[model samples]
Target: MMRRSLTATPGPARLRISLAAQQNGCASGATEVTSARAAIATAQAGLTAAAAADTAARTRYLAATQAVAGARKTMLRVQRQRPYRSARVAHAKSAVAIVTKTMITRRAQSGKATAALTAARTGLSIATTRLAGATSRWKTTCAAVKVTQQKLTGTAPTAELTARAAAISRDVVTQVRATFTTADATTVYGITVHRSVAFAFQRMIDDAKADGIVLSGGGFRTRQRQIELRKINGCPDISTAPASSCRVPTAIPGRSLHEIGLAVDITSGGKTLTAKSAGFAWLKAHADEYGFANLPSEPWHWSITGS
Candidate 1:
């Protein structure tokens, strides 16, 4: 009798299906890793570019500083020489006048006086030329000094441009770091929050979800991230603008509760949470029991202390 096969062989269709599933699983994992690495590389590139720009700006600033110093020195030296140049011109004019008077008074020695007068006039002409040249040099030096000073510290275009560039470079550095941190964070209630607050935040989300309300988005921002948001919202610096006029009230970097990992920005189904929203109302009624309180001015913002 022929021996029978002990195991059943999978049909072609089943084999194909199993292979496809395995491939899909591997592809998904690989794709996720690849995308994360790409994001990291992009963030790194942005940081590098920002750093280079900052270096260039600093170099320009240093060069401008040196230029201003040199220009000021030259200007001072020229300024100090001004009185001397004026005196030389005045003396030349006086000498010419004295020679003419002598020629008018001395008629017997007229030839001698005429020769002396001609020599004095020639000397006067040379002195006047030297004075004019000195005056021109002084004026040019003064203008150069002014231009350099403006470049160094004034609200001149060059100064403004460099200042703005420096600020942008700093902001870029912050943004890149923020991006990386946010990417690495875990999600809580569809919102990216720091690991420390995930449990509490999730509880809040679950409680709200049970009440037929969905909480979404917001939590634990880095200082740099806060700065970027502040800029986008056009929020005035708390140090400068009055509190009443600020449309988006954002705290400065070190002062924000988000930086400490205790705050979250709550929303309802991808919409901003406001006083009128059911989610906001639920938060107001029950969030305090979970150690969360809404910021009065910002309905979407909640913190441990509600400040």
Candidate 2:
């Protein structure tokens, strides 16, 4: 088919006729198809961009979840080993390191290994500091305990009297009774007196107590032990009771070590030796030199050099 070009004529009637045909026919509308196609292309571009964004967000969320899970697992494993003790920290660190390496190797895409490494390092640093403190405390406590045990084992005055002598003296007085006319009645040390020994023992106790042998409020157990031995062994005071009966009660009617003055009570309390009395302190430090050993149960009691 051949197409013809239409030309405008200079006549009002012809222009009117052309306008009427254009309004009545579809051939006159030509640009609407092109505009519709352009709109469809723009909508497709927007949809593609939105889908890509959603995919990226999903990937990021998944990665974060994996990282958190790895961190929690690592923490649980480390905590299980009890890292509070210094001796165990090395093991904890090694365990954390191994777990971190494994996480990195197995989950390469999530950066799990890097996160695990950071957590492990932080945990190890804190654990090391705490462990050091705990170790130091343990050592200090052990040392204190050892010293206390040794002190308990050292000899005191109660080791001196024979069983028979002790029984006889105990029957007389049951315990030593002493009073200082010038000062308070205080305990001194333990001596082996039984109304039968020689004058030498009582002299030692007299000299020690008169010279202020007991320290005020020293070791209580050691002092008390000494006192019990003195009482049971018939220790002396400045009283006028016969020296022979000093170690034995006056009621026993037999010659006691106190009569010979060979035993003395030097304890003030149980498990303690006082520092306030020079005599008591001297006994604690020098009693061994005189062949005297402290009794664990009674700090004040002592046996003779050979007995």
Q: Can you write out model 1's per-residue Cα lDDT over 162-280, one digit (the tens) per residue?
A: 44544543453355335445544677645666564465576567657867998886676777887786677676773455434556777766666666555777778779898899999
For model 2, residues 1-307, the per-residue Cα lDDT tens digits are: 0001122333423433443343222121212333334444544454455455545555765665576566666656656765455545556556657665655554553344345444555555555555555455544543443343233333222243233334443443323323212121233334323332222233344435555653222211233344454466674642344434555322122222222222333554333443454445677655532223344333443434211
Q: Model 1 misses residue 283 by how many Å?
A: 0.7
Give the backbone clash total of model 1. 0
Q: For every model shown, what is its TM-score relative to the native structure?
A: 0.38, 0.21
144: Cα error in model 2, Å: 99
In model 2, state the lDDT of residue 72.
Answer: 61
The candidate that wins on lDDT is 1
142: Cα error in model 1, Å: 82
- Model 1, CA-based lDDT: 0.56
